[model samples]
Target: MAQLSWAAPSAQALLAASDAVRNPDQSFGLINNLIEYRDGKQIDSSTLAVYARADRKTGQFRNLIRFVAPQRDAGKLLLKNGNDLWFFDPSSKASVRITPQQRLLGQAANGDVMTVNLAGDYDASIGAEEEIQDGERQKRASYRLDLTAKNNEVTYHRIEYWLDRNNSRPIKAKFYSNSDRLLKTAYYRHFQTSLGQERPTETVIIDGLDPKWITVMRLSDWAYREVPESWFQRDYLPRFNPEQAQ
Candidate 1:
């Protein structure tokens, strides 16, 4: 039998191509328009801005965020330095340093229920193409995907992801706990290009167990600029950055 010279692109290849196509609109990355969370009987909403970079060698990430809400005068800042996490809330005028266990809880609250479900980690073979609504209008190609964490001990065991096929930006996601119970669902809305890449302008997280527990976040005025590395240090939260509060 003669070997076929051409085969359909691997799922990874197809996904990479999709990402490349959308990269121009998403080059500078994303600014979320909204993020909402509800836990039990409590509901909270915030406006958020996120920046992420993945380190190849360590397979880890540097994720940073500044979050604000109407009830508070100043927002909170969170930095995830690999496994360690640091947080500062201006309203309380306090900084909370998290241990690894606390970091896990924080990650869960932030919708990073599983390591694989974290944004910016891409795998092509897991999803199928579909059509989805873009913002309040416009229909676009999207990929509905299923992903499992490489490690099994995590709280969330499985995740269903919806990615904009044109840009490789995830539009929605559903997370499930180890017992196969629904934990939460996130919706990404209002995508726009900042710094040349397609990114979500808003994100909403709804707690499945408690409808009252919800969080809303919005991102605005996203700019690609260099921030000092020292900003991520726990020691820098209250002492080194007094000027930020002012």
Candidate 2:
């Protein structure tokens, strides 16, 4: 008997697989903790609860990020519907348009927290396969992927992503601006079983211009929940009930 020969997976397949390793397929919620550091000293931190669901028509995730900690910021929400993003404050009861490029913390951008489907929004091409250092500083053999945004609404104009060749797990990524300037570098690590997949639980992001500026994002308490379509609308921001988020 002879073994069957097959061709390698396409770049798109690899990208989609990588996305699967990072995102859940169904409606879900998770706790996101952002810890900002500078020169190895902790400077700031934020806790957020993120509820997300993919749109049936576009396959893009609609996210409602609610601030959970830091009393001054609680009850605030950041809504990401398709390409539009808005910041809503309960105190003022006002919705203000915001851009993804805006920095949320030291090294974390507003776009970074939004639930996004990379494969659904970008064009991908295969790059070199090489040995690289992962988040844990361990040597890993990885495949490089070059991605360009399909539209202007995306967070980054371009991205260079590295995935574990053997498992298609995302190891690291470099984000770029429209002018091709490197904006940030993120390393995905601490994978754990969440909502049926081995998803990355922590992300270490380093500032493009300053190595000392670092933001560590940790995600936890993953669960499949009911995310209603009304939650994605700006008009429902004021009416959103926290108990329903549970």
Candidate 3:
């Protein structure tokens, strides 16, 4: 049998660049705050605590998110297993299937908060070399990338991504649907050294058609965590307890 590869040689280059810009470890924890704005007015906000573990060899990721703010939503849990994600409501005590593209708090998607490795979810290819403005409005050479989803589970069906030529860190990305309709644009900025690696700690998203609709995601509390293997199992979600795990 021939060995199967996820991306072509050209695509692999783009994937390498993406991997360099994100979490490169098997397990980690972070706190994410999602804020939404419309017409320059703040609309909504939410905070979540997330724990994620990835199988580096297989590129399989497992994530667990617990809502930490807005007392009403506190204690709600979301668990990701391979391509399937489930949401658990503490009050209802039910686990319902959910999609990554579904809005989480505002413009942030469930996948955005969970932070999956894009290299594993999409096949990427270098598109064009363009001079683009960075988050700071400084001009820089960037690699424009075309990313196609390998499976249906990804948050977006396609993405036009950009990376800095010098650092290989993600600069900006445009997410699209299967039909190629642009949905949103994201700017990765506020790079800082965290968990021993330099990575973007904030992402600003704007609606494709409505520039006034904006969302900002701020990531903090970066730490290496040892997630229990059993926490990744769907059967264990109902009884999972963060307090006892600590």
Candidate 4:
């Protein structure tokens, strides 16, 4: 029952590994995400095109999401500036403040679809190590990471993250609230080469309270792109040209 304390080098390597899985590009990138929600027997899905740019100084990702599916949601936009997130509905012609905790559809939140690098927002320690079978039924040694939020900006207050000991590929994660209540569990799988790096293609999240409810986010079409500085400005939301995004 002895507790495990991670070494500084191991912790840094783990952080870098998690960041690599989340966003591989050293600077800027874009990806398409398809999200699906399931509750019992009911299922629903949405598609989004996301553009992400990293702040060289802070290492924070500035993301812009454009809904691209189900005619009704088309043209809607979500912008993330630091810790704050904003949603703009083309029909309403207004911008409203939103939080990462808010559900975008069903079980998935806005933060789940955005490009996030956990190393910047979390202070991680290796809490334990275990042997486990991955999605492909491959046995591997893995490290279970205990992560504490460095600040209030992150989506989850605390997290239990698991990653392969050899390659630093994330295997699973459990998200928790400030009160230490379990919120959800996510399994990372379907590793594919994107933007010249292999990363998880799908993240499947199951509700903590209702295990039958599940949400999935699929990432694809990753490309290294140039993101203009003007894109991160709040004033650009209204005038953000969808045509320019493509």
Q: Give each model's whole-structure lDDT.
A: 0.53, 0.91, 0.82, 0.80
Clashes of each: 32, 0, 0, 0
The full ranking of all candidates by TM-score, starting with the best, is 2, 3, 4, 1
Candidate 2 global TM-score:
0.96
**How would you encode candidate 2's per-residue C-alpha lDDT over 1-246 as one tens digit per residue?**
122224546778999999888888899999999999999999999999999999999888999999988889988999999889999999999999999999988888999998888999899987777789999999988888899999898899999999998999999999999999999899999999998889899999999999899999999999998898899999999998777876
What's the TM-score of every candidate structure?
Answer: 0.64, 0.96, 0.92, 0.91
Give the top-scoring candidate (TM-score). 2
lDDT of 4 by residue, 1-246 (tens): 234534424775687777887686654555555555555564677888888888888878888888888788999999898888989988877989888988886678888888888888898887887877775678877888889999876789999888887788988889998899999998889998887778888877888898888877778777777777787777787788888877
**Predicted structure 3: lDDT:** 0.82
Candidate 3, run of 10 with poorest lDDT: 1-10
lDDT of 2: 0.91
Residue 49 lDDT in candidate 2: 99
**CA lDDT of 76 in candidate 1?**
67
Stretches off by above 4 angstroms in model 2 are 1-7
lDDT of 3 by residue, 1-246 (tens): 123244423655766666756775768888988899999999889989888888766776689888888788988899998888999987877899999989886677888787677888888877777779877778877778788899887899999888876778889999998889998999989989988789899999999889899999999988888988888777787788869444
Candidate 2: Cα lDDT at 107: 84
User: Distance (Å) between predicted and true CA of 188, model 2?
Assistant: 0.6
Cα deviation of 26, candidate 1, in Å: 11
Candidate 1 per-residue lDDT over residues 1-246, each given as its tens digit: 122224433555544444443333221223443333335443333444555554455544455666533446235667676656667776566877653223222113643521122423443355566677654556767666666654543334677776665556667778777677887777777677755666565656667777665665555666655445675677666554434422
